[model samples]
Target: MRMVKVEASVSLRRDLDTGTEMQRDAVDNIITQVIEQGDHALYTLTKTLDGAELDQLRVTEAEMEAAYAQMDEELIGALREAMTNIRDFHQRQLRQSWLTTKEDGTILGQQITALDSVGVYVPGGKAAYPSSIMMNVIPAQVAGVKRIVMVSPPQADGSLPAGVLVTASELGVEEIYKVGGAQAVAALAYGTESITPVDKITGPGNIYVALAKRAVFGKVDIDMIAGPSEIVVLADETGDPGYIAADLLSQAEHDERASAVLVTTSNELAEQVSVEVEKQLALLPRKDIAAASIRDYGVIYVARDIAEAIHVVNELAPEHLELLTKEPMNLVGKIRHAGAIFVGSYSSEPVGDYFAGPNHVLPTNGTARFSSPLNVDDFIKKSSIIAYSKEALEANGSKISALARLEGLEAHARAIDIRLEGNK
Candidate 1:
């Protein structure tokens, strides 16, 4: 970590951008092949891209049973506990189809309906992310979505990770597939003989997965396009230098592009955290990766006060934010942006990533300014309810026509006119 003095009029969000070629050509080529060749393309691409040849695309019932049976009781208990927490949290976010009546006999409300099906993409690259299975599947399950299909790259042995498979099975995700990358996304977006097309897709992945999700948008709903993992810690004089350094490294080790920034009011704390980060980074197994991330993108901004630190935090809109000041709760109301806020040193960012009830699939790359963490809402659709009584239509028909005609849409105005005539 390097210390940088926050200057007036200087933008702190300069690094908050992803210009990866969108892997557009490769994504387009892969998606085209999947649409053109169906299951064969999935099979061929798995071997070509992931270097794992798979005779089976779907995880078999036997595989699910084996994964469960092989897992130790401790892991099973931990996963179940985490799943329960996630399920309980999302259940609070579940909405019901509502209809409110009016004296005018005009019924207007929203009908909340679960999507028919959804696909969850779990990355199976260097490590197994069993937490992704819980975070992605539980919300859809809580939203009353009928079908949830899960896809992930296979291990080197061409089998689904036991942790991922067992977790998915425990959470009632019955349709698990052993396919990944842009090809898997194509099969989910547009249907194949083996895998059915879904109404929406959710989860994070590599650049190819992100590009594929972008390509398939409008064709199939997708969660926001995720960029590299990032975390920005906001601290004041009372903050712990050790806690700050360890927390930032948690995200830095995820990828070389992943960013870890510390914005503090005290220059002394900034230097202390930089030294602490180096001391901790030396002992990490992924030190090289974290070092590259810290060397290339890591930064510590010295602010004049808590207000200036908060300003930098809002402008950057980091994926994860930690408030290590004496008054984290008070400052939260002033924050306009940030995907997730971990108050105090006790509320570490990974708490939400795993066992905490909140969804870990959050917006990144300054998107937290507008987007939200994944929730049950992502798995459901809403239809505006409108049942106009004859009296109500008569009361508003002329006004509706005037507004429509003002927009030069005669047909829109005529639509109301025809309905008025029909009632007459």
Candidate 2:
């Protein structure tokens, strides 16, 4: 890890929001094919890209049963437990439609409506994440969306992973599709003969999937254009070096583009964490990937004090922020930016990733500065409610007409004028 002094001039090496030209071109081609050829394009691309030949786009009932029969009770129980925790957490985020009436009978409020349908894309083949399934699906369910369709890449044998299948089955998500990548995003955006179009799409995928989501965003609502995973450890002298090292590696091992940074006030602790990270990397099976991530994107900043460390944190606006200092909670309110904040050594990043109640699908790179973690809000839409009574309109119609005429919208002014005349 490179050590740098905390300063206002410090900036990250990569600007993840900017898409590469290659990625944009690939996404354009993939989206074009899916829109033109529909399912045929999906099958051909799946064979070439995912190395799988599928007879159909939907997962069979027998496959679901076989997956459940193969998995042991322990993993099933754990999935259920995790599902319960996630459901409970998201249920709190469920909001109801509300209205307010003024003295003049003008009714103003919001109408919160769950989307009619949603599509969730989960990456498959070598990287199967059952926990992510829970995180993405459960919230849409909590929002009471009528239909939730799940799409994932299949193995060479044309089989979805047992754990992924069983987890979805337990969650009562029956509309599972055997597809992945940009094509899957297209199918969700514009319906194929086999699959119905969804109102929104939510989940994390590779660069191609992210690009596809960006391409289809206006046609169908998207959660966010997620970038590579990132984490920042804000610690002081009282923090444990080993814990800090382990937490950093947990995100670094995600992939080469992942970032793991540490902003601390103590120079001694920074050196100790560097040594501990090197020691732990040697023991990891994916040490090469983790090491590359640490080498390229990792940083350990030496701050003058806790205030300077917090300043660095706010400037970075990391996805996962861990306050491993002596007084973690006392520092919580001071943090203005972060997708999710992990307080204390025990509240590690992985807890929020897997078991804890909060959704793990968070804003990546520096998006935490403006965005939020995936939650029930992503699964629903809000429509503004405006109801003006006859008396209220009579009182305000002249002002409304004047403003409309001033804006050079004659039709808008006439609409109000005509309504007022009819009421008279």
Candidate 3:
């Protein structure tokens, strides 16, 4: 890790990968095929890309049973407990349809409605992330979404990993599809014969899937164009070098582009952490990936004080921030930007990623400056409600007409005037 004095500002914002020209063209072609050929395109693409010759597009009851059979009772119990924690956390974020009436009988409020359907794309083929299945699905369920469909690529043997299947089954998500990549995104956006179109799509995938989500955005809502993982540790002299090093590596091993930065006030602590990171990096199975990430994107900034460290952290607006200082809670309100803030030593990043009730699908690559972690709100839409009584309209109608005419909208002005005249 490179150590430097804290500057006026620090940033590690990487431009989101928009894919190459060839990749964009390929994604465009895949979406067109799925739109035109429907299930046939899905079947053909699965065989070509995934090498899985699936007879059908949906997972069967037998497959679900087998997935459960492969899992032991202990793991299943842990998943359930994690699900409860997640549901409880998001349930607090749920909002009810509300209205307020004025003295003149003008009713104004907002109506919150869950999406009719949502499609969660869990990445598969190489690894299975049961935790992702929980994070993405639980929020939508809390928002009262009626239909939730899950899509993932199958293995060469045409079977999803037991973990993926068992997790989705545990969540009561029955509409699982055996598909992945850009084609799966297309099928979710524009329904195939077997799969119904969803109102929104949420999850992370490869570049092709990201490009597909970008293409089908207007047609259906998407969570975000997520980038690689990022972690920023703001620590002081009291911070433990070993804990900080382990936390940094947890995110570094995620991707070669993943960033792990440390902004600290103590030069001694910074030196210790640098050595600790190098020592821990050698022990990781994904040493090559982590080493590359540390080599290219990792850094340690020596700040003048805790205040300077906090300022640099806000400027970075990292995806995952850990305040490993002596007084972590005291600095919570000072942080203005961060997708998720892990306070204190015990509150590590993985705690939030796996079990600690918050959604791990957070904004990355400095998007935390404006965006938020995935939650119930992403699964629902809000509609403004306005009910104007006869008296209320008569009182405000002339002002409304004048404002409309000021914009040179004759039709808008007339609509209000005509209504007022009729009421009179």
Which structure among the candidates has the greatest TM-score? 3
> Candidate 3: where is the Cα deviation over 4 Å?
none
- For each candidate, give its TM-score against the true structure: 0.95, 0.97, 0.98
lDDT of 3 at 272: 98
Query: Of models 1 and 2, which has the larger TM-score?
Result: 2
Tell me each candidate's RMSD, in Å, in order: 2.0, 1.5, 1.0
- Superposed model 1: Cα runs more than 4 Å off: 8-22, 418-424
User: For model 1, how many clashes?
Assistant: 0
Instruction: In angstroms, give how far residue 399 of model 3 lies from its true place.
Output: 0.7
> What does candidate 1's lDDT look like per residue over 1-424, in tens digits?
6677866432224353333654678889999999999999999999988888888898888888888788999989998999999999999998888898788899999999999999999999667899988888899989988899999999777888788888888887888888999998999999899998999998888878888888899999998887778899999989999999999999999989888999999988998999999999999999999999999879999998888889899999988999999889999998899999999989999999999889999888888999999999998889999998888989999999999999999999999999899888
lDDT of 3 by residue, 1-424 (tens): 9888865445688888999999999999999999999999999999999999999889999999998889999999998999999999999999899999999999999999999999999999889999999999999999999899999999999999999999998899999999999999999999999999999999999999999999999999999999999999999999999999999999999999999999999999999999999999999999999999999889999999888888899989999999998879999999999999999999999999999899999998888889999999999899999999999889999999999999999999999999988976
Q: Write the per-residue lDDT of candidate 2 for residues 1-424, one digit (tens) a residue.
A: 9888855345443666546898789889988998889889989999999899899989999999899899999988988888898899999999999999999999999999999999999999887889889999999999989899999999998999999999999999999999999899999999888888999999888888888998899999999887778899999999999999999999999989889999999999999999999999999999999999999988999999999889888988888999999989999999999999999989999999889899999887677888999999888889999999999999999999999999999999999999999988
C-alpha positional error of residue 218 in candidate 1 after TM-score superposition, expressed in Å:
1.5
